[model samples]
Target: MERVEPMTLFGYEKLQAEVKNLKEVKRPRVVKDIEEALEHGDLKENAEYHAAKENQRIIDSRLAELATFLGCAKIVDPSELDHVKVSFGSTIIMTDVKTDEVFSYTIVGGSESNPDKGLISFGSPLAKQLLGKEEGDEVVIALPNSKKTFEIDEVKYQEIVFECD
Candidate 1:
C-alpha cells in the first residue's frame, strides 16, 4: 500500500474509530436488516432486501478504503516541525493587497482540512503559494481569473493538538 502523507494522530484515531463503527455496528446491523428483509419472501421482487444488500456493499467498500488508508498511515506530530518556512501545521497570517483583506489560516494535512473552519490543506493553491515564504514576504498566486498578491503578515509554527472530524 502507498503511504499516506503526514497523517496526524488525531486523524489516525478518527479513521480507526470509523472503521470500527462500520465493522462492529453498521455491518452487523445491515446484515440483520438484510436477513429480516429476506424473510419477506421472493428476493426478486424484494426492494427492501436489495436495498439493504446494496447499503452493505457500500459500507464494506468504505471500510476497505479506510483500512487501506490506515494501513499506510504514519502518524506525525506538529511539534516535530522545525523549519520556520511555511509547511504543514503552520499558522499563517496574510494580507490580500488587492482587497486589503487580512486573514489567518492553519495549514493542515489534506485529510484534516475544513476550509470553513480556517484550516487549509497544504495541497491548496494558497498554501502552496505560502510555502517556503517568511513574514514580510510577498507572493503572487495564480487564480482562476487573475493573479492575486498577498503579503505575509506573520508566520508561526503551531502544534495542532485539537481536531474534530
Candidate 2:
C-alpha cells in the first residue's frame, strides 16, 4: 500500500494548477514546436528537433512528478486545526532567546516548504522542535553552525490561501 502524505490545501491547489498548465498549455506548445522542427529537413543534424524533443522530455518528467504528488496527497485544511498547541498547519510567532529577534512561520508539509516565505516543513529541524509545543514554551533548534533557543510567543491556525497565476 502507498503511504498517503498530508499536504496543505494551498499546496494541493498549487500542484493541481501546475499539472493543468503543463498538460493543457505547455504540452501542446511543445508538440507544435516539435512539428515545426521536423519540417526543417535532415533528422540526423536537426538541432531544433533535438532541442524540442528535450523540452518535451522535461515537460513529461515534470508532469509525472506532479501526478505522483497528487496521488499521495491528503489535503489538510488549516481552518479545521486547533490553536491550542503547535502542529502541522499551525502559524507560530517565536522570539530568539539570544538576539531578542522575533519571527513568524507556518508549519507545512515537506512538499510546500518555502523558508523564504516563512513556511517550514514538518520534517525540518525547527518544525520538529516546535511541534506539540504551546505558547510560552521554549525550545532549542540545532542549526548547521550552532544551536539556538526560541520562545513561542503565539500560536494560531489560519487558512493559507494561494493566488493562482
User: How high is each candidate's TM-score?
Assistant: 0.88, 0.91
Model 2: per-residue Cα lDDT at residue 83? 73
Off by over 4 Å in 1: 159-165
Per-model tally of clashing residue pairs: 0, 0
Instruction: Look at candidate 1 and tell me the lDDT of residue 45.
Output: 97
lDDT of 2 by residue, 1-165 (tens): 997868987788889889999999999999999999999999899998999999999999999988898999898877787878998899999999999999999998888988988988888988888999999999998889989999999999866654454
Candidate 2 error regions (>4 Å): none
Error of 1 at 103 (Å): 2.1
Q: What does each candidate score in C-alpha RMSD?
A: 2.0, 1.6
Lowest summed lDDT across 10 adjacent residues in model 2 is found at 156-165
lDDT of each: 0.83, 0.89
Give lDDT tens digits, candidate 1, residues 94-114.
899989999888887776778
